[model samples]
Target: MKSNPSTDPPAEFLARMSALLPAAEFAAFLAAFDRPARVGLRVNTLKISVPDFISIAPFSLAPLGDWEPAGFLVTDDSRPGRHPYHDAGLYYLQEPSAMVAAALLAAAPGERVLDLAAAPGGKATHLLSRMAGPLPDAPLSALRRGLSSGGLLVANDVHGGRARLLADNLARWGAVNALVTQAEPAHLAASFGPVFDRVLIDAPCSGEGMLRRGEPVEWSAAIVAACARRQRGILAHAPQLARPGGRLLYSTCTFAPEENEAVIAAFLAGAPDFTVIEPARHAAFERGRPDWSAAPPAIADQLARAVRLWPHRFPGEGHFMALLGRDGEPGDEATRVAPFRRVPPSGEQWRLWRDFAEASLTVALPEERIHAHNDRLYLLPAAAVAVERLRIVRYGLLLGEMRPGRFQPAPDLALALRAGDATAALDLWPDDPQLAAYMSGAELLQAGADGWVLVAVAGFGLGWAKRAAGRLKNHYPRGWRRG
Candidate 1:
């Protein structure tokens, strides 16, 4: 597929839009497709504040809105993805409109949060950034020193490949109290019950929104219908995962009402506990079209609370979002779900990890939350539950593994730690020649005392290197090496 896409949209798609929109409005909507899409760089508050990032950013950036303090639009072609700051877990280059849903979910710090269908980790990263800290003296634990300290995020993608990718992105975000799992939505609902305080389902849909972005997706009316069916099936598991009085946000990056309001209407028909909550109005946000969904007057009236962002109406690609609020608060004894059965860190792997942390890290992890999954040792969030039957791609933070008598750290640990959190580190400027060499899997010649060294770009942790024989041998993952 060509990285640069053609400006013209599919003929059938244009025809559908003409029928859906008013004549004058349709003309403007069509014109939007011919224009460029707005790219977004959501700041990682877990790593740096928006003001701080702006002060140091090399790329041109403009704030999207005050509604989202961390959200910004990239104003120029300053390929940030290749920058050293990116490797430092600074920001995520997400689509502008796509950034809205997570903010709408308003996942506060110290809440038990879940990002269903989380992949490429965009929304999951946002939720975790806001979720870093204690889920209180409860099940969730996003523990850190000062940044809201306790809460936990459970991000799941059913596909194994996408789940792995999700794990990588969240790790790079320095998420400590999050779990990345590969499982069906129903399986998660069954395993955890309604334990989460906030649940976000960014459903897969027909790529009508990507028409302007030039995403290589073949769209058709049949596909829209298929997507709507799948969306409804997925939403069936939503209510079961959300705690009473908790919030659930359903979103899709599509212009189709079938996948937006219609799917929401269908979900409401089956689940009576949820009520659509109107979000705080923004000038760019338009109410959903009830008639478009062919829903009844009463149901349609509630669906009107849903919001739509058109490329023509908003400074972004198209998107649809609906926030549903579950009815009561969390005090039902029957609804309580079991937490991840704690297997206190033991055996050779546990001993090796303890040795490494004692020598390397300035802080100690919670022993009760440490889970030894097979040969690897994972530091799970406090809210994590046992999933012996489920397929887990990444279980919390993989501190490292034990090989015979020695412990080797994972790159995930480096990213999750601060430069100051480690006993020793190699801090370098973004433009340092050694930065390129480290990324290229080249060893750095350094004369220093070191066991496990945290490599930092500027002041943030990037990856790792080990100092031995008067030199820092590169321990950067081979797959991430770039020339």
Candidate 2:
């Protein structure tokens, strides 16, 4: 069941943990790796409701824990990752413990949120869903209204490749009110000062949780020390992005006390304006050990307010989360730093995009906020903040390319829409042969008028196809095609 057989605990790691854990708890923690790691998935509530997804679930799925509302545990050997439902963005395969971070942050509607280290966007997607508030009904007309409620998520990662993957994941989640950015923490702080309502730092740390992945991780005191140093450095610039009374959450997958308590302790010591807020408690959650570090006497007790998810106790990989609140009440919106943004011209840019939307979509596009970068057109979120010179992977909903006299829609534009939004959609069951054909980049014969068509799997947008002369040509991205 494990990816590698070298998951046996390192002697030094065992020795260190033996000193840290009590006899019975240490035995359980050691035994947890011997069992197969359970697979977990969080439903994309933006696309489908949890109950509806549960009614049609293809596998043995159960609630993950009390930790996350949308989180579920997959008890079967079924590879949901390889299924069409996953491709259609019904649920995301995530470690159950990883879901605990955003749950603790608890972003609300209309909040300007930031994920300081978002990549492949697990937590960022969760944040966007939470910020979406409540949905209206099943065949979602409120999806646009939910996304447009002055809410926007700034999901950033330092790596360019990871940033692109993150954008792709958010797109599949049908997240239209998000901006994907590739920039370091310091640069972000400088560009947008004291603006975000909620900020999360899922800081890079020593991979003690790699044990759950069945990967043999070389553990040492030096490795934990290096990770702690990097965490402290990145966290130093985080407070500048938080507005007064805003919440900033710090989390790590490592069990290292140095990475967890020591980093937060150090940040609090340097910055007097922030204090730890006791996280919402769960039965599986354990209190953080402030005694594990040389924390100041004043905040040492408050550090216990942080939560720890140990594999011996929680039903997933190890993770640590601590929430902090900035001093003073929430301030006015004008205090935010605006990025350099220009109005896209009305002449050539409008023609192709308008033509595509008018012909294909049943709903109206937000034309006022649509901006262009070269030939590419993007729909910006309401009240968006512009970044002058950062490497932004995505501005908003990438409407697609406006080339010559025609417009080519992005894969994202299709995913962001419901089957009802499309003028023509081919809704097929999961076992349909044409569904596999479409995902594999093969064309199909269909009864339809010639133009753009949304190929759907069980009423969910899978990708786009163009129909001409009763034949459907696959427009699904070649890179995304399944073998």
Candidate 3:
């Protein structure tokens, strides 16, 4: 039975939306939207085991109805802000509906992938975690070859600040196989034409799904029309960047058809060889609404292939996704420039930093990967090369170690790692007292056995350090540290 329109919406919002969609349908949607869904998050497998993470979390971690095992429905509660696990990087705060796009792009280990707008690093981290463990030696070799030569993910964000934030998230998740680039869609397409195996186009859109978050958009015809134009602009070049037979997962957080089905229709109409992959592969997936489907030659069947998550139907923000792939394209087998450069370290500075780190922490770091750049010695992935040509915003520093002959990581590397580098330091766990001190601007002496203790807010790895006897000095930059 059709629901009554007036029964569902606030009198004011209904008045505005009445002219937009069918009054009855708009009312039903508002009725659903009013009761915003609970928060959800995906556990980072690269950091901690799911069971171990849940056990340590202060809040209840319920399994999500539709997402994978690592995904959970994080209940909306007063404790979200105060929770120590959050500070520790135990999990990423993401909506359940948003997980669909990333989970869809979970390629086999070593597949060359791209996250076109991978800022704030949520989906990028998820993809890397899936690529771990033993893989076909050839693909694994290709993947590592790319990592050594810097051929893995090119996580690009146009914004400078957000790009740094993305790097931090990826590093904390212990990613060591990615390259961070800052460029626009057109720029990327021109540089690496049709080379990626998988591409995630989580495009920007009007904040329709964020109505509960106080998005200030008015439900007007002009607003929707404008957003539709923008969505088309963002997705127009997506196919150009995707290799033939490769997957392009397009997604948006907004519920508007202009940004969802309409955008997909436009892309399909322009790109002839691409066909949409069905979402039916997922056990609980639901097809997109038919009434919103576009005209012929517009991939109408593909609309059915798309997945939709209405706020009322799912415990998350509204989202839509379509996985499209091109047929009959030759496989990618391109080689890349080597990623390593035999740059020597400044012996005196290297020794000074090493001495400080060894006496302060418990873990041991390899010395070969440590080198000097711009007179500042940095501990980087041994494979990283020729970063000077690119405008490098941040390359993580390798601080000293705990015991003599052993090295530890510095906490600040969270703000400075590429995806494929093996920057994971053993012995650091979220909630270690040293981590809290680091977050609060304190430099700490190693106090644990073997002098190895994890420094983190939750369970995420920030960096490693050595134990010392002097009063701990705070390294937290005044601008970045929160009280």
The residue-level lDDT of candidate 1 at 292 comes to 92
Candidate 1: segments with Cα more than 4 A from true spot = 1-7, 133-148, 333-335
Alpha-carbon RMSD to native, per candidate: 3.5, 2.0, 6.5
Count of backbone clashes, every candidate in sequence: 14, 1, 40
lDDT of 1: 0.82
What TM-score does prediction 3 earn?
0.76
Q: Of the candidates shown, which would achieve the greatest TM-score relative to the real structure?
A: 2
Better structure of 1 and 2 per lDDT: 2
List the candidate 3 regions with Cα displacement exceeding 4 Å. Answer: 1-27, 76-78, 133-151, 217-220, 281-284, 329-409, 412-438, 442-470, 476-482
Tens-digit per-residue lDDT, 190-282, candidate 3: 666666778888887766666654445555556667878877887887776677678888888776777788888887888888888875465
Candidate 1, residues 1-483, lDDT tens digits: the string is 123335467778888889998999998887776677777899887767667789889999988887777888899988999998888788998988888898789887668888999998999998887766222332211125322366678899999899999999988887877888888998998777787889999999997888887667888999999999999999999877888889999999898988999899999988889999999988798998898977888789999899899998888888999999999988673245567776665666667888898888876787766777667787877666566467878778887877778888888888877777789889898889988999999989887786888898876778889899769989999988887
Candidate 2 Cα deviation (angstroms), residue 319: 0.6
Best by lDDT: 2
What local lDDT does model 1 show for residue 16?
Answer: 89
TM-score of 2: 0.96
lDDT of 2 by residue, 1-483 (tens): 223345676668778888989988888888787777879899987777788889999999889766677899998889999999898888889888989888999999888899999998999989987888766574572236444566879999999899999999988888778899999898998888778889999998888876666776777889999999999999998777888889999999988899999899999999899999987787788999988989878889879999999887888899889999999876665254575385684577788777888888887876777888888888888757878568889888787887678898888888877788889989888999989898899999898788899888888888899999999989999988999
